[model samples]
Target: MVRIAHIADTHLGFRQYNLDEREHDLYNIIDEIAEKILEERVDIVIHSGDLFDSPRPPAQAYYAFKRFLAKISGRVKFFSVLGDHDTPKRRGMPPQKLFDDEIRVLGLTGGDHQVLRLNGRDVLVAGVSHFSRRYREILVEELKKLDVIAASHQVSVIALHQAVDRFFPFEEVFELRLDDLPRNFKYYAMGHLHARTRASFGKGELAYSGSTEIMRSDEISDWEKHGKGFYVVDLSGDKLDVREVNLEGVRPQLEVRIKYDAFDLELKKLVEFLKTYSGRKSPIAHIIVEGKEVDRQRVQQSLNKALLGKVLYFRSRIIEEPEKEFIELKPGDINISALLKEYLRDEKVAEFGYELFKVLKEGDVEEAKKIADEYFRRMMKIDSEKGVS
Candidate 1:
């Protein structure tokens, strides 16, 4: 029997553009989650990928990761497969050993996948780390090679980082199809998609243990408020039981909507909203104000007081010119007058449309009414061949 903890996508050094103090706040939250793992006394910790937001994280991020490792050293064995973010050559060779050898971390790049004997049974741990985006599909090929070795009743688990088959729009990068994976493995532990999902494909259990921190807005809507956590896998012979371990002290996300014709009135209303809703320990706030010519600075400045004494992240956008031209249509710019021409001509608009739709929270409000109506109309017409109302 082997007890393993699976977590991924810490995304260290991620910049929090909206809030002044949000970056450090997220880092601290991750530390808390790691500490919880130590307290649980899991035998091994497996990070699927994306340890750093960049291939090279800033000094602060390095120190934070080091501190986290210090807390769990000797207590739990940590093994991780590098994601696209962990650049192997950028950091030089010696310090890389600090992650692999001294840290008791074992995975691809440091060592090839191997079979371990536990309780008189064999279990194979096969892994491949952060291949460059262009060549990440090598993972599928590597798995095929492993399938040549036949092991009867042995549980083979693959820790993979890349996206697969557009699990979500955001997860389309390392995109793979169900056919890409080998047919022999018993378990497939995956990352990069920030959702807890389970599926049976090719005689194996495919599971994704999402991120330990919530940094993206869409993660909230898609994950059903279940983004922050790790998974505990209890392995006994040929069967596996998985459970979620919630990290404590995470602030709940607050989506506040205040509408006014005047920007001044909107600012005043925002302050009042913050004052009434703010909490000391866990303050995750997303503020959206809709009006014409909204003074972004005034609203941000006024809410400063309300934001103090709490951990809050605020996002604001001004939609003053509602029907304003999104793009200029020129005679030379393809015939946008036609529906297909309009949709396919501007790929940028389509991408922007997806991004905007992800952030607009409320569906039953006047602010998002037009935006939602346009999105549904276009989507239905294109994908379903239904006319816009």
Candidate 2:
């Protein structure tokens, strides 16, 4: 019987909310996973994609990965593909060279398939790196080629870091439909999306191991539902037996929404919820207020004082209803700067927007343009550095 560990979207070196401790948290979780691998004594580890948060990972990030491999490299074989975040902006330069040959990093520059002989049985592994809408045809062609090769193998698996039509709503124009995949493969291991999912495809099963940690506020709900973990697949039988091994010590996260009229009641409820939390550590809370003309500052200050040290981070998201009953329009009644400030708060870009509005309102067009450019550049840099997006 072949035991394989399927993991993906580790996103190592991700410093969430610009917190250094969060960076350490990522490394800690990886170490735990490595220990689990040793305990399980799996034959192979298949990391679908996203080994590092960025293509050009920081020194600490690289060292963390190296340490992880050192723990289990010789005991077990590891295979991975390049995720969108792991792809370099500069063309023709693949990041696979950074690792030793002990690990087989595929789908970087060209190659897409590898065959491993285990326990007198042949296992074929195929993959494709992140690509845009323009390369859908190329991706389809490659899958067909892999399908032909898989026909001769005992077990065939395909790893990918792309959105599949069955998993998510049809929002992305470049998403891969279920029909695009070849029917011959035994299993499809997926990544990129941060949610645990499993769907049947033709004669095989397609599953996403999901991100190991929470990377964004929107993922909080998904994490709460499925938890964060990797998959354990036993391919010895005719039907695959897949199970999830949830990693322990993941920081908890909570999302709360309160109407303006029920602020006091909701505040009390939140306090009760925190006081009763039985997790190993305090959770990060995202409190969202929804209503018209609510005093966001007053509520936020109250929450901060009440929940101080009780939660790791207390974030406030205030969404106010637009005023639509204005009898007449005044010159400054619809101040663009004021509107921008409110919008920025919702978007969580208040700091940049504040500086931008200051320069634009001062009538310095050149300075405003520079500020705008610098703001976007900084945002992109942050996104790239933390693998957010």
- Candidate with top TM-score is 2
Per-candidate Cα RMSD to the true structure, in Å, reads 11.8, 9.9
Candidate 1 whole-model C-alpha lDDT, 0 to 1 = 0.63
State each model's CA lDDT, in order. 0.63, 0.79
Tens-place lDDT digits, model 1, residues 1-389: 77678888877777655453566766787788677787776766777887776555677877888888888877776767776555553444422345664343334452246666755667677666655444545656676776654234466667777677636433323456667766776767787777777777555577788876666665666445565688888766456778888766544566666674654566566556556644454456676666677777877776665556553556655455573365345434542224343665776456545434433431213324545667667776786655434
Worst 10 residues of 2 by lDDT: 323-332
RMSD in Å for candidate 1, one decimal? 11.8
lDDT of 2 by residue, 241-298 (tens): 8988898868888899888888899888888889866656778889888788899779
The alpha-carbon lDDT assigned to residue 371 of candidate 1 equals 54
Separately for all candidates shown, the number of backbone clashes (residues 3 or more apart, or on different chains) is 2, 0
Model 2 regions lying over 4 Å from their true place: 92-96, 277-279, 321-389
User: Which residue pairs in model 2 clash with each other?
Assistant: none
Residue runs of model 1 more than 4 Å from their true location after superposition: 18-21, 88-96, 103-111, 150-153, 169-174, 222-224, 261-279, 282-284, 291-313, 321-389
